[model samples]
Target: METLDKLFEDTLRDIYYAEKAILKNLPKMARKANSTELASAFETHIEETEGQVERLEQIFEMIGKSPRGKRCPAIDGLAEEAGEIMQEAKDDMVRDAGMLAAAQAVEHYEISRYGTLAAWAEKLGLSDAVPLLQATLEEEKLTDQKLTELAVSEINVEAGNAAEKNETNKPRAPKKVAAK
Candidate 1:
């Protein structure tokens, strides 16, 4: 049987580690994003992440655990994959599209973790942790919705047009010259 403390500590480690990785990754993501909207989104999230770190510290203090981060290999891999997408994407709109997708991936991870933590906090009767984690979770969800809105409202259409143009520009096989 796992003690509540162990579960809570593990959850704290997961979020703490994820936030640290996010701090490193968001700047690169902002750089890669094409649209002002996308760039702003990344930049805003960077600020939010800083606040999240502070909140985590408060949670740690409440829990009697010194604030610390454990290694989050999952986020490391996800950030690497997003970087590769940025490198491979050609057009500005296409890159923005990829950026939105990557951002959503990150948001989903955060939502899942935060949701779990909130549930665990409630189960463990850690009322204080519940509100703290819930706040972060709400932000994660809102960010995800903004990314989706960006994708559907503009980025996807622009990328689609750019892709179509590239397809049209490709040299058609030399039209069969009628060998009279």
Candidate 2:
């Protein structure tokens, strides 16, 4: 069985990879977003992700290990799906909704990873690392909540309206001619 310390280190590398991937992808997401607020949110998160990466580096230093990332397939898959959603969606409102959903998916993944790492750090008595992990975890949770609020407040309703408009604009069957 892998020791808890080893597991913690492995997870750290995974999240480190994820954060770097996110930094590269956020600009695309921001550009694809229809709402200015949504775009701004993505932009803001990019800076926050930068900080998270630095925090991960600090954790590595605390443990006397080099700061580097291993392959994190889960983040790769999620990012691919998010990109697909942006490309596939044509309507602005609908695309915004899709982007919000995709972002929330990423945030949720980060939250889970950070939470686990923090717990593992605590269990391994790496008390110094716990606070760093917990801070990232909290930021992930807050970002998720903000995405939820944005979806509920505007994006979802706008998408619904767009769907309704499309349905209303569809061609209808011709009416029968009147019989004399």
Candidate 3:
């Protein structure tokens, strides 16, 4: 007999897997973004995502489970879609637009998962997990909003206003990071 408690744990593991998958994918997305604003947003989200992963680990502790991830096909698919956008779009602004949409897709998926996990946690009487899940949920929603704002305020304007010149279509050289 399947119980909500079991369902909750499964969902938790799914999100844990998704977050880890997202961590691996974000740097690639950041490098591939032509818009500095979009790239910077990806970089910032990496830190927020690190915090989200920590919260997921804490929730696992409350449930007496080790921090482990079940394979999440949804995240895998989203990552594949992002990769496709990176590969297919040759124009800088075009790539930026596609990447922006792909990123928001990831955020939307995360928001949905976190919302469900938080609601289930509360219903299951896991008070400790609720706050942790809710915190990540809020972060996901905020990231989604910021992405929207970025697209509207900068990327769209840049895309629309870019001159019809060869220079506008060229790929950018990524900033060299200092090795720690």
Candidate 4:
């Protein structure tokens, strides 16, 4: 059986790797975002991610382990999908909406992973890890909320309006073809 320290170390490394991976990917995501608000959110989160990395290092110190990461394939795959979504989206608002969806996916994953880690920490009596994970979980939730707010207030509505404008701009088929 894995010791409590081992499980805690494993989870910490998982999140550390995930955070580093996000640091690499977020700049690209921020660049691809259509709304300034979305871009700004990504930018802000990138900064938060940097701090999260530092916090993970602190956790490593608390646990008396070297600060390092195990490869997090989950975050890698999610980042890949986010890149693909940006490439495939048709227009600015659609792209922004897609970005929101991708960001939300990331947030949800982090929430689940952190929540599990927090529970495990508490179960194992790793009091130090619980607060760190909880803090990260809260940040992820807040990021998701901000993205949802952006989607409702701007991106989705803009996409709808753009669709309506496109429809209005299209030339209607002439009625005289029946005579021929």
Ranking by lDDT: 2, 3, 1, 4
Query: Which runs in model 2 stand beyond 4 Å of their true positions?
Result: 172-180
- Candidate 3 residues lying further than 4 Å off, grouped into runs, are 161-180
* Model 1 lDDT tens row, 64-117: 999888888888888888888899987889888887888788899999999988
Task: Judging by lDDT, tell me the better candidate of 1 and 3.
Answer: 3
Which pairs of residues collide in model 4? none
Please provide TM-scores, in order, for all candidate models, with all chains considered together: 0.91, 0.93, 0.88, 0.86
Query: For model 1, what is the C-alpha lDDT against the true structure?
Result: 0.88
lDDT of 4 at 125: 81
What are the per-residue Cα lDDT tens digits for candidate 3 across 112-176? 99999888888999998898988899999999999999989988777666545655688879989
Worst 10 residues of 4 by lDDT: 1-10
For 74-114, candidate 4 gives per-residue lDDT tens digits of 88888888888889878788777777887788888888878
lDDT of every model, 2 decimals: 0.88, 0.92, 0.90, 0.85
Q: Write the per-residue lDDT of candidate 2 for residues 66-137, one digit (tens) a residue.
A: 999999999999999988889899999998998899889999999999999998898888899899999999
Error of 3 at 62 (Å): 0.6
Per lDDT, the best of the predicted structures is: 2
Steric collisions counted per model: 0, 0, 0, 0
Clash number for candidate 4: 0
Residue pairs clashing in model 1 are none
